[model samples]
Target: MFLRFGFVVGQAGIIGTMAIVLFSNAITLLTTLSLSAIATNTKVEGGGAYFLISRSLGAEFGGAIGLVFFAAQALSVAMYVIGFTEALVGYLPDGTSPTLVASLTNIAVFGCVAIGAAWTMKLQFLILAAVLFALFSFYAGAWTQFDAGIFLQNTGSGFSGGESFWTVFALFFPAVTGIMAGANMSGDLRNPARSIPLGTLAAVFVTGLIYISEAILIGGCRDRETLITNNLVLSDIAVMPALIAAGVFAATISSALGSMMGAPRILQSLARDRLFRWLQPLGIGSGANSEPRRAIFVTFLISQAGILLADLNTIAPLITMAFLVTYGLLNLATFYESITKNPSYRPRFKFCHWTTSLAGAIGCGIVMLLIDWQWAFVAISLFAALHWYLSKIDLSADFGNVTSGLLFERTRKNLLKLEGELYHPKNWRPFVLALSGTGFSRPHLVVFGHWLTSRTGILTLGQVIQGELDDRHRRRISQERMLHAMIGEHGLNAFPAVVVASDYVTGVEALVQCQGLGRLRPNAVLLGCPLSVDRMKIFGGLLRNLRGLSRSAVVLRRTDEPADDWKPPSGTVDVWWRGRANGELMVLLAHLLLQNEDWRGRELRLLRVVDNEAGIDEVRNHLNGLLKAARIPGVTKVVVSKDPELAIQTTSRNAAMVFLGMQPPNIGDEEAFFYRTEKLAGGLSRVVFVQSAGGMRLES
Candidate 1:
């Protein structure tokens, strides 16, 4: 406020001060132009530096910068309070005691700052407008005192007196620092690009002119120790101490208000997008839809904490120095894009291919060269460390909850239409087939696999209703439903066979249980897999049982798909008349196979497995003897397999169709079983076992 304090720098130092003023102006121009360019392309949603940087760079950079912006804004608010109180202290009349007024004013400004930190944009605009007018009056008031020749007198030489060139440079840095205060609010602007550039640049120009004007005006007042007296303006209508203090305080408050208006929204954006998880928990709203307010509060709170521990007086130069590097990075980002000719490099506001930005950085470094390096080092190092951490920690790892897996998957997905050969049918329409229901699931699976060897089916769901229930009745119904559903679903109405579950693990045992006067016997006895260890014993029992039960051969299949996509397998009937059972069943199976396609002679594998040397000799002899009478080609095999299942496995190795006798599961059991002789789930196989009594059966 005093012309005396302006004389703290000798006349010669004012010349250096003028240069400092010019440097600050340059910084403002650069800050404004850069921020404006970014603002136009992006909607200037609040979150200040955080919003602008994140959109231009990415979420990580934005998040880290948001913290810095918030910190700076909060600190400025406190600095405003202190400045206002000091001005009030200076404003008290000489005769009146100033302590009470100074103390009360300090408390008042403190409250005002707290409220301002949490204030709305409309209210802030008012404060800014009022304070701006007050600040303008200072410039107008001082304008009349300005003299061009005073500048010439002060220009003794560069770094005259005890000041070094770098010392003068350091003084200018803080003056430029205020430009960033405006830049931080670009995110809140309606048109960031245009407004950021214009507001920032204009502020710097106006502020720098005012600072220079004040220095010039004060310097010209006198060579006296104090430039202006306390009552000078009141006495002769000249400079007034009260007016000066009030004006500066108002300007400071306005600048602080701008900080509150702008910075936190950047942090809020970071929180929303998760520039970092560490930052996401901040910006909690006090009211409904108070995102901006919440962000501002958090920002102010942190900045206040920082300022309290080491207020602006202590940290101002360090902040300016840290921000110098910040500006340089921006310039470098712009430079890299411009030089690489990357499409994003094109700028709306141009200044010699990014030199304007570089100049800001170099100028910042020059000022820092003379300031407190310890503080400057700490600030710059902390910022650099933060940037490094942000880069190294993947946002996905650290802030993954902010977005969805779908987005990450899509972003990282390779350009492929299909993952693999999902399915193929030679461009044919998808085939439809069917399978029956199951008491449990094993039987239907085997049956479906058998059908799928030559056809495709759709998934079918079946449910059965029984009016009455009891343990015995329930078992009966379950079995009945299984059989009926299987028979109905696979369209086996024309066939006499039905899929059935068996009490015994043996295939022939199942056959026995399924056989009765009205009960149906399946043409195919499908075995999922050998359910018992002694499959050979089961097969032998099946052979012994087949003689009387009058069931038929079995088809065993394997598949991985669900019971859907199944249909009756394709095969040709090759019948061997081993007995009356074989003769009748061959006639029946031949009829069924022929219904689909002509039966080829090669498909007739009348296989019979003989257990021992004597049985084999007898079987070969029978084949020769029976063939002599029939004049038909019949396959006869004699294999030694102590294991009953092995015998079937060996026989199935060469024969697609194995004709053998069918056996009942047990005496009095309506459905009987046939031992499966093949595991050809992907192909077609039929095993027919003729019973001694009624007829034969063929399975695929």
Candidate 2:
């Protein structure tokens, strides 16, 4: 208040400066309330704001903001030390350098913090008493000098220094940013959740009243020229100038000590999480209470760098930008927690609403830009880069975060909305259920299903654990995890579903019927081509059941090539257009496959075999027209042959994958149908026998 209050009053005048103070404090108060809500909801530990944010927002978000917040706190030490130097410089000998004074002040603060938070906190009481005494003296002296005419004159803004309202706002925002100082000391507190909200809120209210009263009193008593030219006007207006000087020393040093203590704890928390390898050494605590001595040394070095900058205003905006970023993210985290309605987010502090958090976030962002757009851009960009880097590290948190809850809420709403919309062929997307057992065992089946979906649709890797639910419940869970790990290992965009039943057939049936939710339910079922005759019979039965349920089925017959040699298919995808019943679905699936990066440049060939050459031209023309109508890139071929299966083998021998239309066998002819499919897929690299159960279309 002593350092920048006069500057703000000078630039924005009495009313404008008071308004900025009120606005900044109001935003701070709302943010504090949001912090209170989150703090009360969980068991907050040592890291204070960092702990709360990381626990609520997940590791990546928390880690990134944690580092940024640490930087803000470390630099704040320099800002406050510079303020202390400014106050002490007036009493120093002639020609004493302000930078030298700032350096010394920083060292003193470092020494105080090095002694530990207990000793530093003990000093805060004396500092608070001095500050209160200073405020009393200033108000007492200001009342004697106050005149109605001067008060009226200073009420409106007079921009003589070419300073804007936002610039002044930036100077004053740091005063309220200290509300988190107590939160940063959460580790040292007896009960963080209870202490943080009450203590921090009370500090905000009391300080806000003090700041507003001081602004009004100073502006009413002092002339504009004096306010603008003098950075130490408070001392001149005090009943005892020496008391005001003591207050300046006390307030700035107290803030510097607070930052010095808080920043290291934040760094220590980050190091403890092992987010960055180099920070691991700093994670080690020195004593019984786990003091962050190493982190303190690092923070001291950063503060010394900040103090070297020498000017309070220069360091002030940088600290403001960092704090705004941290505060804005905190608001967003709280807003997500509330909006998602996560049951675990129940807070004893109910005064905060989601809208308040939203408003606080938006207000912080707007203030950041208003103060300095270039700085805000740099700050936001740096934050984004850090977030991206942390996300890439794949950090995991032990506690639940709002990200999953937010996604689940959004998915729930979209699913319900989709449930109400009428289905249309034009809007159709393949929702595939790949019954690939453990997925790792039949990697080809899972990979093919993912390629078929192409991320525009949903692909679920389903496993059927054969046993009773009570007997194999744990196995089902383990297999589900394995399926998910398989998807991650293969880098496939898919979901996993595992079920336990008495037998393979029952498990498959259960998966087919209950794999997805609402409109997101699977429309296509993919399974590997059975190797044995008995398994083929079961596969045939499954196919019949799927057709009866109007679900398209894809049977993948992989070659005997070694798994090491197997890779994403790269050559042509041949589609044998036997009839519209399966041809359309086959064409659509091929198009979807080509959408994936693995099959991005692969060719699509639509082929048909005619018994004779009499109508070959007509067949070719129809295929070309179909491709044109479908707006899919592919070549057309018409082959004249007596045997259709032989023609397919001869034409697509070297193709990457073959898509053929198939019909389910009659009730007692599963053996014959299986033999025919085996013959058709003979010597093929990969064959996918597709049977459409109607409703699928290529052209709407």
Candidate 3:
């Protein structure tokens, strides 16, 4: 405050400086309230703000901001010490170097912090006394120099030296950035949720009033030229000039000490989480209170680098950007907690609302870009890189975070909205549920389902356990987890579901009837062809049941090739167009498959088998017109064959994948239908028998 007040007033004038202070303070207060809300909602421990954030936002975000916050705190030590050095140099003997003074001041702060937080608190009381006395002296003596004309002249902006309103704001924002000082000491405080809010709010309010009052008084009493050029004008206006000097030293030293005490604790908390292996040793604490001595040493080195820069204005903006980024994320965390309405997020503090937190977040971001777009970009890039790096590291936490809750809430709302919308063929997308029993045993079924959906729609890998729900509930959960792990291992975008019933067929029926939410439920079911006669009968029965439920069925008949040697085929996808009943779904599924990277650039062929050659030209013209109208690229072929099934197998024998139309078996003719399907797909590489429920259209 002592160092930058003149710069802000000189650049933006009195009214602009007051506006900056009020705007910054209001946003800072909102962010503080957000912090208080989160802190009170849970049991906050060591790591202060980092603890609250990591536990709320999850590890990646928390760890990223913790590192940034730690750097800000370390740089803050240099900024404050430099302020103290600036005041001290004015009173020192001629030729005294400010760099040497700043280095010595940093060493002094390090020694005080190393002793422990207890001693630092004791020193803070004496420093506070000096600051208050200095304020009293300035106000008491400024009345004699106050003039109406000078006050009016300083009220409007009189910017000079290439300094705009935002430039001045960048220099002054650090004044209000100390709101998190209390939150950073969360580990050392008793009942932190209570003390942090009460103390931080009070400090912001009181200090904000003091800054506004000082700006008003200084503007009225000091001339524009003097205020613009003089960094130590406060001392000139004070009745006891020496007391003002004492206040500058006291205030700056107190701030440096606070940062010195806070930075190491944040680092220690970050290390204790063991997110990064290199930082593990810093987590080791010594003495009765377990002081972060190693972290302190690291902070000291970083501060020395900041001190080497030596200019307060240059260092101030860097600190401003870091603090703003941290503050914005804090508000965002709180806003998500509130918006998601997670039951566990019940905070004792009620004054804060989601809008306030959102505004605070947005306000911080706008200020960041307004100050310096280039530096803001760099700071944001660094933050994103850290978050990405931390996300890649496998750090598990026992406690729950809000990310899942947020996703659930959003999904719920969208599902409800979808339930109200009208369904149309133009918007049709496959929501496939693949009943692949232990996907590892029938990998072809899972792979086929993935190719059909491939991120354009939803895929759920479903498993059926033939047992009573009471006996298989735990096993069902375990199976579901296994399926989820399988999806992750194979890098497939899908969900997992498991159902238990009294019989295999009954379990499959249950999964078909209930597996999704609202209108987002599965529209198609995929199954692997049975290898045994008994299983083939069951598959025929399932196909009939699916037809009655108005659901499409895709049955995959894999070759005798081993699953481990199976790879996505690079040849053409052949679709045998028998009729519109299953032809549209076959064509659409082929299109979707081609959208995937593995199937990209592969050929698609639409082949039709007719009994005579007389209608071949007419059939070719019809297929070409359909392809042009649908905007789907494919080759058309017309064949005259008395046995259509034989022609299909012979033509697509070397195809990557073949799509064929099928009809559900009559109740008593299941065995006959199974044999026919087995013969039709006899020598094909991989065959998909699609039975569409007539709910989709490719040309729409």
Clash total of candidate 3: 0
Q: Residue pairs in steric clash, candidate 3?
A: none
Candidate 3, poorest ten consecutive residues by summed lDDT: 418-427
Worst 10 residues of 2 by lDDT: 418-427
Number of clashing pairs per prediction, in order? 50, 0, 0
Per-model TM values vs. the true structure: 0.49, 0.61, 0.60
Model 1 Cα lDDT, one tens digit per residue, 87-149? 555555665544444334434444453454444455557655654555455556556665667
lDDT of 3 by residue, 201-288 (tens): 9999999999998888889888888888988888888999888888889989999999999999999999998877899999999898
Model 2 over residues 1-700: C-alpha lDDT tens digits?
Answer: 8756977786788899889989999889889989998887776778878888888887788889989999999999998888788778778899999998888878888888888888888888989999889889989999898888878888899876567777778767867888889999888899887899999899889988888888788888888888988877988988998888888888888888999999999999888877788888988887778889899999999999988854676777778888899889889989988876543455768799999999999999998988889989988988899999987775644555766544433567666755644443544667888877764677778778877775557788888888788889888888888877877887777889888888887887888888777766788999888877777787888888888877899988887565553367557999999889999999988878877777778899999999999998999999998876565779999999998889999999988889998988887888888789988987887899999976655544
lDDT score at residue 354, model 2, on the 0-100 scale: 98
lDDT (Cα atoms) of all candidates against the true structure: 0.47, 0.83, 0.84
Can you tell me which runs of candidate 2 are displaced by over 4 Å? 409-700
